[model samples]
Target: MIDGLDPEYLDACPAPNLAAMAQRGFRVNGNGMTPSVTNVNNVSLVTGSYPETHGITSNYLLDRQLGEEFYMESAEFLRAETMFQRATACGLRSLLVTAKDKLRRLLSDGATVSISSEDPPGWVVSGVGEPPPIYSLEVNRWVLDAGRYAMSQEPFDLVYLTTTDYAMHTYAPNDPESARHVTLLDEGLGAVLEQAPGARMLVTADHGMSDKTRMLHLPAELGRYGISARAIPVIKDRYVVHHSNLGGSIYVHLDESSDLNAALDTLRNLDGVEDAVSGEEAAARFHLMQERVGDIFVLADPSTVFGDPSEVAMPAGLRSHGSAHETTVPIFGCGPGLDTSTAARFRQNLDVGRYVFEDVLPPRPDGLLS
Candidate 1:
């Protein structure tokens, strides 16, 4: 999975390798599930279903029972079977390589080999027999390097490699840094093609990217109406250096006596606030499970984002995405056995695993379904 690699950004970047690959195959704008957070859409890609089915609706979750917010990092919270699990049940070998440790745990439940960049020593030793620098701006490249090495040496029946989003989070689509990152990623894609010459590869991204020029403190705004609300940014993660928990979507949990409509109206009337809906309404519209959402859902426009009141300022050149405003991702296929006749048809993140399981690799002859 190419994390945070938007189709529009890809088009604007100077990556001839990726452009050529897209030309040889079919390319279409795939819709990401809302809110367009990384983990939410990544789970959607693997489970072939919406957040309502997989139960991971956002990158950060607010637990009513615990009265606390936490980053989502475990597959135990998933409500549906993943493509990796299904493949293993059918006696197919699976390999999972991720730039982030949390994703490895969340998606590697049934994989035969799972390596994460979080454990740099183990990852490098396993693949190249030597460890590189622990962490750097080129972490995504290292993950891809390991993936290519694995494919060349000990190939698996089903392989899923997820990259990092540091570059997309910090650079504009056409910026030199962004273009450089895309070029490196394209080279890694070429390596994968060489390693697995005839594999029916599906190239796609978790979510799109957007520029955040302003921050909306939803909690502070709700306080104007005497409504005490806890605003949980849906994009919160360990990688706060990227966006500082500021994103286009957030959840506001209100007290029992507060006027919900008044709060909603106050937010809607405010600048930068795009839409504010009740949790139930948001669940229905976004295909999210109601129980997992907060009391009120707040979404921002393309130029704005929601965040908690903080003394820390947003870093320069920060970019983020976690709302319907930037929900379009690119999905395509190349190599042998891929059908390009219906490439123009609309697709969503939920279709990725279904296509891979049903089209790329069908059920084994043993009829194993786990």
Candidate 2:
């Protein structure tokens, strides 16, 4: 498996362990779901539904007020049904572990609390110095220590390691920085595998990352146009060919009126604009809900992103992930029944459940993981 998580970094993947895994199993070909963010993608994989059905479309989703803050607790997962819950209902041992704490709780609510996990976030915010959102190096240390402790105490039905994902978010795959992080993750996985050599060992990540230089400031740039909003949580990937003129504000409500056609026309006339797809179209494309996103969708060029919140030194534009652009993520496998050959075409991390476990629901750790 790739130590670093980002898909864009996958081309740089060594492909030995993963290729062996693919040789014995299936691998994904096309890019994963849009937004392709972690929390949204993991929920989709667990539920086998789109973000719309799962009701979570991002790692840092905006609440009704369009505030920058987002919920970071297992309780907020009341949004939709998850696969881990299904596993529990079926009496299967399901283990959900990740650098993201939100992912673990959403996957298996009220199970365990890894204050150091990569949930609620593992993000590098703009103003606040990027702290470890949920999982990261800290999680690796904690999980390794926890796993060893649990093994000594008793056997677990399932186990999860949640560091590789965090490593990728900061270092990205393929880069030297990523290599160091991936190596660290590999060490942890190696330990987990040694502990449970026979149990199904699944290695997968939510989405990939692309190393990019150009940054798009959606709020700052759009403000110049009548298309300004206090907020704009993109319902879709940042458009490469976009309507730079038709700026918009994102909220739980959609009320962009004042001659819709004119607004559409102005946006379409801008450079790098594909088409002013309505909220409905974006919902259909990204599998999001109408109530959760903005009304007007500004489709940008695939090559250029509209905005990214990761860059701190600048206004806002360093890395992005909201367009159809490809970001290579990892979906490696290690199990007895696993094929370990041939990568599955179009394997979204969301589809990882099927690969790891045979049953409809995932396996649990029987109090070992929590």
In order, candidate lDDTs are 0.80, 0.48
Clashes, model 1: 0
Measure candidate 2: CA RMSD. 7.8
The CA lDDT at 255 in model 2 is 35
In terms of TM-score, which candidate is strongest?
Answer: 1
In model 1, residue pairs whose N, Cα or C atoms come closer than 3 Å (at least 3 residues apart or on different chains), thus clashing, are: none
**C-alpha lDDT (0 to 100) for residue 165 of candidate 2:** 44
> What TM-score, computed on C-alpha atoms, does each candidate reach?
0.93, 0.70
**How well does model 2 score by local distance difference test?**
0.48
Model 2 agreement with the true structure over 334-355: per-residue lDDT tens digits: 5665553434423665556444
Residue 39, model 2: lDDT of 53
